[model samples]
Target: MVTDKDGYIHLVQYLTEHLGIFENSQQQSVTEDTVMELFEEQLAAQIIMVCGQNPSLTFSQRNLVVREVDSIVYDLEEILARVSGHKATAEQSVFISELSCLIKNLFDQEIARMISL
Candidate 1:
């Protein structure tokens, strides 16, 4: 969203100052703070669920998934930060990691198949 100055300005204005989070916002029905809270709650829930289901892959295989997940999470974090106009919290980082691990698990067999080729 922050790909350019105009776009960045628009985003910041909309999310930070214009999203009804501030008194200047004309629409108070939905604030940025409320939306952020909802997202946080959902992210926390996803992380909890995923972390509860630990993968049974080997050390090397699991680590490889983790590494790839990290890369994806980093990009996700960057995009989220831009959209929210805030840095990612530690909890969010954990959520991302757990989500990544779960995704890796889902594709573990496929990855193993490809690796054996």
Candidate 2:
């Protein structure tokens, strides 16, 4: 089965291309705050899109999804602050992998809940 981590790779690749999350400093002003904001927006948009597909989702369910996404984004802000300006590729990869796992778990739980109802 294709896991959320696999899907996250695709999602990150899309975000990197469209949002320039890893672009050179001269090419874009990629601050941690900006990256977090963009990421939150993208996550919200994706949630909204999924909710749109499942029109039976109640208001509380939608709110829960928003809350969860907000919590993750908040955590991401902290992670970004810690890792920002660090040039070590291995360290970055480790952080990214862990974050992706966290995100995948969140998505899996939320999507499972959504699917059950």
Candidate 3:
């Protein structure tokens, strides 16, 4: 249960981190802000649902989850830095597209893991 919760938390952290990267990379536009806000809300709901189900997890377990989240945050920061630009190169665009797909896969896997738990 603890592991399941940890995975979900980590998944959300990854999503938000990427969203932040996207936010920072994009111009200060209303569309970007709206999309980022929506993404944040979606992640927040997932975190709440996962934690609510496994309320008995230990403090250490929770901390472990947070640590994983932090790690992904750092990773996303790097990925964002690489991809952010008004005119991304072909390689940069491919990297961003691949990263986006991988993040989506991770979210799907985490949701399945939570359900199985």
Candidate that scores best on TM-score:
2
User: Following a full C-alpha superposition, what root-mean-square deviation does model 1 have from the true structure?
Assistant: 10.8
Cα lDDT, all candidates: 0.42, 0.52, 0.46
Query: What local lDDT does model 3 show for residue 53?
Result: 56
Model 1: CA > 4 A from native: 1-56, 84-109, 112-117
Candidate 2 contains a number of clashing pairs equal to: 0
lDDT of 3 by residue, 8-108 (tens): 46645665565544545344333332332333344345455555656765577556555544564455445444433334433333335454445444544
In angstroms, the error of model 3 at 28 is 8.8
Question: Which whole-number lDDT from 0 to 100 does residue 38 have in model 3?
Answer: 35
Instruction: Give per-residue CA lDDT, model 2, range 3-104, as digits (tens).
Output: 234554564454345323333334434233444444554556656666676677678877766676666566556546643443424333433445555564
TM-score of each: 0.34, 0.49, 0.40
Pairs of residues clashing in candidate 2: none
Candidate 1 accuracy as TM-score: 0.34
